[model samples]
Structure formats: C-alpha cells, structure tokens
Target: MRDMKRIGNDRVTSIGLGTWGIGGKEFPDYSHDREAIEALRYGIELGINLIDTAEFYGAGHSEELVGEAIKPFDRDELFIVSKIWPTHFGYDSAIKAAKASAKRLGTYIDLYLLHWPGDSFEKIKQTLHALEDLVDEGIIRYIGVSNFDLELLRRSQEVMRRYEIVVNQVKYSLMDRTPEETGLLEYMKKEGMTLMAYTPLEKGILARNKCLEEIGKKYGKTAAQVALNYLIWEDNVVAIPKAIRKEHVKENAGAMGWRLSKEDRERARLCV
Candidate 1:
C-alpha cells in the first residue's frame, strides 16, 4: 500500500499477489485451494489491490480462485490483470480467451496482456487488434504484453495505434537481470510503460540471500523484504511476488513503506 504505481488510470500497490501457483495441480506446491484463497484474501485485507493471474494458469483455475477470493471486496477498488495464451494469439481466439478469463474472474479485467509474442507478425497484429476491440467493448480497460523483447514491444506498439501498451510483465529478479541488461527496463521507462516484474524473488532464492539479509538488518526487515523492496523502489516498476501462505503474505507486505539507500540499491545490484 505504501508504494503505489499507476497503470493507465488505475493506481495499484507496487506489491501485488501473483496467482501462478494458486491455479491448482498444475503447480504441485500450490495444491491447497483453501490456503491459496485465504492468503489472497489476507493480502487484500492488508491493502494489496493488484492481483495478477492468467487463463493459462491451471487452465483458468487461477482466475476462478481470484474470483472467489475477491467476492467480498468492492470490484472497483482492485486492479485485476490477466493474460491470453500465445497459442490464442489471433483476432478471434484472443477475443474468446479474454471473455473466458473475464467470466472466470467474475469481473471485467483491468488490464489484459498477450502472454508472449506470436510466431508471426500477422498473428501478433491480429491479436492486438482484438485487444483494442475488447477495450472498445469495455471487456478490458487496457492492453499489454508479456515476455516481449525490445523489438517485439516496439512492433506491438506500432500495430496498436488506438491504445498504448501500458505494461510489460516479465521475469525479473536479483538473479535474473536480463531485462535491465538488455536495456528493456530503460526502453520501458522511456515509453511510459510499467515494468511488471514477475518472479521478483527468483522462486525464493533471493529471499535467502546473505547480502539482502545484511541490508535488511539496517531496515529491520527480512532478506525477502529487502529483495522485494529493491524491485518496487523505482517509480516505473512493480513487483508481483506469489505467496500462498498467510505468514508469507504478511512478510511480502512488509516490503513496502520503506526506502533503500542509493548505495544499498547499487550494492544489491552488484551482489546479485
């Protein structure tokens, strides 16, 4: 709740709940439906309004869990993001996927993204056109893409002249710095797009880093919190770390409301 990043007209917490595992048996570690629901609800109760899910996740089970977990909250208060699978990249299939995801989420999607680049430019063009149409029809508020490199992102923007691509979700963590190394982070900032960092914890590796732990001691936070804070400390970036346990959710929330010094941020970058 402390670091709020704006996506289009919506302002959401820099720290969001990711539902990749909550999708069900597809992820062996997240088979507990009840715990997943409880953790999501607990996150929202703590003012975490950004929830990221996808139709491909558990073949739509993740959206269903998100739908159930968000039932008690005002729909307008949350920013729900979902994605269309790469195989569904086309005018018709993309539209169908968006509608199906919305139905499962039990609300209009705040932002819908193309999960990845298609095999052909024509295919990508068709999918972007469909997303533009969905925005026109009010099925989705904004359009975006994920796992795109610099050229694909540029091409996607050129193809969709009607609406701006507001976000680019990718795997970025202390361990995986490819986005920054390849200048994708700089390009995104230049184009006014939010870099939605998925797997910001590197699947728990950075959570146990000795460098992050040392940095966290100064802030009275955990290494995981320090690692997460490093991601959201910037203005044009947001980190969505998945947590299916109440205790983990609380720890994730603790990453907010504090700032890391410039030296420490640089140290983290070098250490990782």
Candidate 2:
C-alpha cells in the first residue's frame, strides 16, 4: 500500500473513490448495480480506504449501495465520506439528514460534509452547529464542506465550535487549475485543511492526453495515472476520481506510491 494521506487524525488513500454515478445521479438507476457494488468492493480490497459519496447522489440510493458494499469489510479500516444536500441544511434537517445517511450506510460517516455553500449563511451556521451535535452523538467523526470557495470556507470555519473543517472537496485537475489560480488551494494548505480534488481527470480528457502520455511513458504509467499523480503531488491535496470499471480502479490506485520529479511535475502543470 502507498503512504496514505492524513485527514485530521485518520489516514486516507491518496487516491480515494468517488461515487457520483455508481448507483445513479440525481435519480436512481439500477442498470449496473451489481457491477457498481463489485467495483466498490474491488477498490476497497485494492487498498483504497476513502469513499466519498453524497445524499443527493442517486437520491439517497448511493448511500444504500454503499451500505451494502461494505457489509463484508471491517468498517473501522475504511474512511467513509458523505455529504448532506442543501435542502437538509439547518439545525433540525441537518441532524435528520445525518441520521438518515448513517442509517443508510449502516455505520457512522467518517467525514460528513455540507454538499455546498447553499443559499443562506444563517442556514450554514445552523447546519454546522447541528454537525457538532452529530459529532457528540456519534453520528459523524469529522466535519467538512464541498464546492466551497475561500470566503465560504472562512465563514464556515467561524461558525464551527467543536470540530475543525477538515476538507474542501472541489473540482481540481491539471486540465482545470482554477483552485490554484484563485489561491483556494494555498489557503486550505495554510489552514491545515485537505483540498479534495474532484474530477481530477477532467472527465476523462486526461485519460488519453498526449502530454501526460508522454510523461507516463518515462514512468511506465498511463495518462490517467500521470494526471492523478500530479493532483496529489501536493502534500495537502488528495484526488478522488470516480471509476466504475475494475481496470480503471486498479489504474487509479497506481497513481500513488511513487513521486514525480520536480521537472516532470512542472511539465505536467503545463500539460493543459
């Protein structure tokens, strides 16, 4: 196994699993349910410990599938991350949503995140308080936010009383370097927060890139592996690329466990 990254007090696979389309998207789709479950179990067996999912995904069915996938594994060895949607942001609804997600997963979530910044700061405050409550109640182990900008991250932090905001899951990849351009990545690093990079492959554009492929040739890796490697090159960053196929999961797991030289990393930065 590669050296896992640190999220608060827990260790996570540098290349974690992202389950957005596995069970479904906004609505439920069971066309590939068996394959999805097998893919998830395969990833876990290959040493990918962190699994990120959301309540909005599959309209709660993703959580259900996730709950089913991990039944045979030791729950304590895995780090599960689930997010509550905007509709569930409030003192009451947040707690309710957490319980619902916990029930679906058949285990307490390791990291519970607000799906988005949402509409109201007041509501965000209420949700944070409720998350702190959930922590005491043993519903969630850590609190985090997704798709949050620097300002929103600071605001969320201000309202946090008991637990630290440990992760900010956002779109980050060599193809889209907006986080670096906006200094959001730097700020998160300065504050000791993890920058969870979603869509790290740019929706498969990097899967067959000429530039990344050239770099991969030198290291005997695929273009996707090169791209995912560049994302986690930073100590504070972790890349979560969704892969339903067994081959893709195995390829993604290969992204970690090795380091790219300084010059090659700079070359990757200029790939896109």
Per-residue error for 137 in candidate 2, Å, reads 0.4
Determine the backbone clash count of candidate 1.
0
Q: Relative to the true structure, how large is the alpha-carbon lDDT of every model?
A: 0.90, 0.91
* Each model's backbone clash number: 0, 0
The residue-by-residue lDDT of candidate 1 on 1-272, one tens digit each, is 55698898789998999988676654655568778899999999999999999998888999999999999999999999999998998899999999999999889999999887868889989998999999999999999999999888998899886899999999988888888899999999988899999999988999889988998899899999989888888788899999988999999999998889999998888768
TM-score versus the correct structure, for each prediction: 0.97, 0.98
Among all windows of 10 consecutive residues in model 2, the one with the lowest summed lDDT is 21-30
